[model samples]
Target chain A: MSSYHLDHLQHLESEAIHVMREVAGEFERPALLFSGGKDSICLLRLAEKAFRPAEIPMPFLNIETGHEFPELIDFRDRRAKQLGAKLIIRTVDDAIARGFATPKPGIVSRNQLQTPVLLGAIEEFKFDCCIGGARRDEEKARAKERFFSFRDSFGQWDPKNQRPEIWNLYNARLNQGENMRVFPLSNWTEMDVWEYIKKEQLEVPTIYFSHERDCFRRGGQWLPVPPAHTGATTPDPYAGARPTEKEPVKRLVVRVRTIADMISTGMIESKVHSFDDIITEISAARVTERGSRADDKASEAAMEDRKKAGYF
Target chain B: MSATISHSRPPVSHPVDILRFNTCGSVDDGKSTLIGRLLYDSKSLMEDQIEALERSADITGGGQINLANLTDGLRAEREQGITIDVAYRYFATPRRKFIIADTPGHVQYTRNMVTGASAANLSIVLIDARLGVIEQSRRHTCIASLLRIPHLVVAVNKMDLVDWSEERFIEICDQFNEFLPRLDIKDVKFIPMSALNGDNLVDPSVHTPWYVGPTLLGHLETVHIGSDYNLNGFRFPVQWVNRPNNPTDRQLHDFRGFSGQIAGGIVRVGQKVMALPGGQTSTVKEIWTLDGPLPEAFCPQSVTLVLEHDIDISRGNMIIGLDQLPGTGMDLHAQVCWMHQRPLQRGKKYFLKHTSNTVQAMVTEIDHRINMATLVPEPAPAELVLNDIGEIRIRTAKPLVYDGYATNRLTGSFILIEQGTNATVAAGMLLPSEQLVRPESGDYVI
Candidate 1:
C-alpha cells in the first residue's frame, strides 16, 4: 500500500479550494472580494483551482479606499484581466461623494467608511455570497468567524448568533436580502499564506518586496511620502491640520508586510527582499501582521466593530 | 564553514505536515492554560504578545500573567473568565505545525466542541488530577468517541496539585480505561502534566520522575495521522463542473471537467468510475490540478477529473470507484447532536446538507438520547433539547449516497439547517444501512 499525504501548504490549499468550490456550487450570485493583498492573491489562485477549465462562475469585487497604493491597484486590475474575470470596483470616495457615507472629520482613513460601500455593492449586485480572504489567525474577532459567516439584511454580523458549521457541510442557505461572507482562507495563518505563495509561486504586488522610496516616520513606523506637487500635503485626509512645517520626510529603504490604504498601511524598515526573507522575518517577528495597520491600532476592538457593520 | 552554517539552520526546509487537535475539559481543568504553556514554552509567543500579556495581567488575572487569555479572545469571555467560542491558535516547531481548536468547556456550548472536533485529527480530554475523571471529562471523551476522532490524549492535568503522585495518574488512567472500551476510539495515550507550571508539556518535568511517556508537544509532533483517511473506496462528490469557454486559449476552449475535493479513496487516470444516482459509468481520462494534469489523486485532495464520456452529471453527484459502492437510500438512521435552542421534534423539516448536496429531510423518529454523565442511552424522549445527543431516523426527499461515519468522515456526516431561519440546528453522523432498520418496526400498530 502506498501512503499519501499532503504537507501543511498542500493541506491548506486543498481546504481552501474545497471552500471556494462550495461557494461556487451553493450560491446563485457570488463574487470574490479581491483586495490585491497577499491573502486575496492566494484566493484568486484557489478560485482558479476550484473552477479551472471553466471560468470562475463569479465576478471579482473590490471595495477600494481610494488612497490605495498605485502598484496594488495596477496589480489587481492586471490579475483580473489575466483571469478574464469581470472586476467590479466600488470606492469609498464615490460613496462619500454620493452622501451614502460621511467621512469623520480629521480622520483620513476610509477604513471604517468601507462597510457601507461594501454593503451597497452587495445590494446593487444582489450578490448572495462574497468570498473574502480574512484569516482566523489575523484578529480575535475573526477567530470567531465561521467559514460561511452570515450577515443580516442590513449586512450586520451578529457574532453571538452565528450558525454552527461542522465538517465540510456548510449551510449556504440564506433568505433574500441576507448574504454570507465566505472565507476560504479561514484556517490559513500568515506563515501558511506565505508558504503557500512560495509553493504555488503566486504573484503579488511588488510593494511586498524591499524597495527604496521617500518615506517618513510617524507613530514610530514608516509611512510613504506622497508624490511631490500632488497638492495633498498630508497622507491622511482627516489628519486634522497640515503639519506646521511638514514633518521631516526622507528617502528610506522599506517594505510593506501588508497592503492596505496608504494612509493606514505602515512600512517596515528592512532589507529583506524575497519570499524566503519575508517568511524568515515573519517567523521571528514580534508583532502580528495586522499590528502594522494603524487602522486596527486605533482601538482594541476596531476589527470587531467594523466586522459587525459588515466590513470585509 | 559551509557545514557549520548548515548545522545552525533548522533541519526541515519546507513546511511540515499540520496536526489539528482540540482540547475539551471543564472550565477549571486548565485546557486554556495547557495550550498557553504549549505555545509559550515552545517560543511561539511573540515578544509584543508577551508584553501585552504582561500589561493585561492586572485587569484579567489579578497581576499574574494568565496563560488562559491566549485562547480566550472575546471581551465577554475575558470578563467572565470563561471560553465562549472556539478560538483557533497556530504554532509550529521544526517537525510539525499545529492548529489548536480551543473549545469552551461549558456544557451549553457542546455544539462548539462538536464543530471543533469534527476537523481535528486528535482530541485532548483534560482531566484534573485532584478531581480524577469528573462527569465533564467523561462527557467530552464520549463526544470525542462519537465523533470518531482517530487519536485521544488523556492529559492528566494539574499533577502538581496532587503532589505529582504516580498513583493518582494511574488511578485516573484506569478509570478512563474502564469506560473507554465502550467507545469506538483507538490510539489512546495518557500523559501526566501541570499545565500551570509547564510540567511535561514541552519539556521533561523534574516533578514527575516516574512518568516515561513523551511530553505533550513531543507526542503531538510524532503521532501517526498519515493513515487517518480512508484510501480503499473512491468517493468524489461533484461540487461544480468546470467549463471555461475562453476562445483566446486553446487549452481552456471546449474543456469540461467535474471538480470537487476527493472525499475518500484514490482516483487515477484511466480508472473506471461511476457517477451515483445517475448510474453513469465512465473512465477517468485525466485528473487535473492547478499545476497541470496529475497521474492520480487521493482522499482530501481537491482536483478536477475529466471523464472519457460526457454524462448527464452536475453538482450534487458523487463519482465512485466500481469495486466498493456506497449505500444509497432515502431513510437514514443517524446520531445527531442538536445545536439550536429549539428542541428537535419529530416531523420537523430541515435542509440536510451532506458533502455538496442539500436535500429536504424530516425527522421520522427519535430512538433514544444518550445521557452524557452515564454514557448510557435513555429510551426515546419527547424531543431532543439543545446539546442533546440522540439517535434519530430521517427520510430525505432524495436518495443520498454515503458510507457510515466510522468509515468515511466526509461522506458520512451532515448538518441540518432549519428551513425558515436557515440556522444549522444539528450535526449528524450516519449509521450503516444494517443498523438503519428499527427493532421496533415489528411492534408498529396498524
Candidate 2:
C-alpha cells in the first residue's frame, strides 16, 4: 500500500502544485521566479509535477542583476530546455540601458536593481501572476507574508493590504496592471524542500553539490576573488551597473552549496565534496541555508525587506 | 509498525509521515520557551542562528534569548512581548520533518491560533504545572478536538518548579483524561517536563524517573500521523477552468480541463466521477502534472484532470468518485470558534468560504456555547461571544458537496468572512448533515 496521507509534506506539495496549475489555467501570460537557487529549483520540480505530460506551461523569468554567476546562465538554460519550458531572460542590464533600472557607484550587488527589470517584464508580458517558491519560514518578515501576496502596478508588496489565505483556499483574483505573487511553497520548511528533492531525485545545479571554487574573503564572507565585486570607473555593458571594491581580498578554500549572484552569495569554507557528504553535513548543521547568503545576512528582516521591495 | 499506532488508526497509509502541529497556550504557560527547548534540545538549531541568538540576546527579558522571539516576529508583538501573529518553525529528524505553528495565546488572537491550527494534524497544549489546566488550555484543546486533529499531547510544563512531583502530574493527567473523552479527541499523550531545565524534551530526565513516557520531542517524532487523511472518498473542487485559447495551436486550442488539487482518494485515468451541482458522470481521460502524464493521481497532488466528456463545469464545482460520493445540502451544521471582537448573533449574514467555493451564508441557530471551565454547554446564550466555541447551523445560496469534518478536512471545514470588511472572523468544522440545522435569520432578530 502506498504510505501516503495528505499530511504536511503531501499537503504542502498539493497546495504548491494546485497553485501552479491555477496560474497556468487562470492567467493569459505568466512567468516563474527563477534565481538558480534551491527554492527556485524546488519550484521548478513542483512546476514540472504541476503541468507534466505537457510542459511547465510558463516561461522562466529571471530578473538578471548582471551580477549572477556565469555558470547560472548555463544551468538555467540546460534545465529549461530539459523540461522544454520556455526561458524568458529579462535583465537589469536592459532595464538600465532603457533607463528602467538604476544603480549607484561603488556597489557591486545588483539585488536592488532587479525590481525595475522584474516590473518591466511584468508590464511587457502583461503577466497577471508570478509564481515563486518562497517559504514563509525563511525569515521573520516573510512569516507575516500572505501566500497570494499582492503587488501594485509599480510592483510593491503592500503587507498591510494583504489577502487572507483561510482553509487552504486562495483568492487569486486580480485587476489589470495589478499582479499576484503566488508562493505555492509558502508552508514548506527548508528541510521539506531538501527531503522532497531527495525523494523525487530532482536534478539541481552542480554548484549546489559542494563544488570547489576560487573565492576571496570580505567581511567574513567569500567572494569569487578578482572579477567579483570589482569597483568600476566606467559604465558597465548591462547599463547603470558598476562593480566596486569594498576592501582588500583574502583568498580562502570557499564553497557555497547554494549559489546566488556572484557578488552576494557568501561562500563557506567547506571541505565536504559530494552530494552525500553535503547531505550528511546538512543533517547535523545548525545554520539555515540563507545564513551564508551575504545579501540576507545584512539585516534582520533582509529577506522580508527585499520581498516587499518586489524581490522574490 | 504496530508500535506506531496514531490517534484512532484508520488502517490506511498516508503519503508522508511528516506532521505539522501547533503549540498553543497562555503566556505564563511558557509555550514559546517550551518550543525553543524542543528545537534546541533536538539539535535542530543551526550554528549561525544560535550565534545570532547569542548576539541578539533579549535585553529586557533577562539578557537571555527570549525563546519566544524565535517564533513571534511582528514588531507590535516583540514590543509588547506577546505573540500576536502565527509564527511557523521547522525542524527534522532522520525519520521525518516537523513544522510547528507557534500561535499566540492572547484572547484577541484566537483567529491567529485557529488559522495556524487549521492545517495541523495534531496539537500540543502546554499547561503550567502550578496552574493546572486553565481556560486557554481547554479552549485550545476543544478547538483541536473540533478541528478533528487526530492526535494531542499535553506537556505538563514547569515540572521543575513543582519539584517533579509524580502525584501532581498524575492529578493533572487524570483531569485531562476525564475531559478528553468529551472533547471527541481520539488520542492523548501526557508528559511532565521543564522547558527551562530541558527535562524530557530530548532525553527523559532522571528526576522524573517515575514517568515512563517518551520525551516531548520523542513523542512528536514517532507519533504516527499516517492514517489521518480521507483516503476512502474522492473529492475534487475545480479551482479554475483551464482552456489554452491559443487559436493557432490546433491541438491545444480545444482542450478544456477542470483543474484542481484532488482533496481525497486515488483517481485513476478512465475512472468515473460524478460532478457536483449538476450530477453529471464523466470519465477521466488524462491527469496532467506540471511535469506530465500520470496513470494515477491521488489527494494533495495538484494535477489537472482531463475528462473524456466535456460536460458543464466551472470553478466552485466539485467532482467526486462515483463509488464513495458525498452529501450535498444547503444547510451545514458545524462547530465554529468565534474569532472576531463582535459576537456571533442570530439573524446575521456572513460569507461562508468552504474549500474553493465562497457563498453567502446566514447563521441558522446557535445550538449551544461551550463553557470551557466545566466543559459543559451553556444551553443557548444571547450570542456566541468572542473566543466562544459552539455549534451552529448555516444555510448557503447553493448546495455544497461536503462530508463530516471527521471524514474529510478539505470539504468539511469553512470560515465565516465578515461581510463588511471581508475579513475572516470565524473558523468552523462541520458536523454530520442530520445534526445540522438550517437557521433562518428572518425568524430571529439580533
RMSD of each: 4.7, 6.6
Model 1 agreement with the true structure over A1-312: per-residue lDDT tens digits: 245888888888899999998888889999999989999999999888888767788999999877778899999999999998999999998998899999886676788999999999999999999999999988777888999999999999887788888888889999989999999999898988898898788898999998998777777677886534354664544353222255677788888998788888888888887889988888767678877888887656677788888888
* lDDT, candidate 1, B58-85, per-residue tens: 6656678888877777767777889888
CAPRI verdict on model 2? acceptable
Residue-level lDDT of model 2, residues B1-446, one tens digit each, is 00111212112122245678999889868888887777776666666666665545744445566666666665556667777667778766655667788877877666677778888878989899999987788888987877778889998999988888999999999878777778788789998998877889988898997999899878887887766667787789887777766577787877777778878888889998877777777899998755567898777667788899989998778888877666667888888888777889677898787777878899988889888778798877779877788888888877767878888888888888777655556788887675221222211111
DockQ of each: 0.62, 0.37
Compared with the true structure, all predictions reach lDDT values of 0.86, 0.74
Clashes of each: 5, 28
TM-score of each: 0.95, 0.85
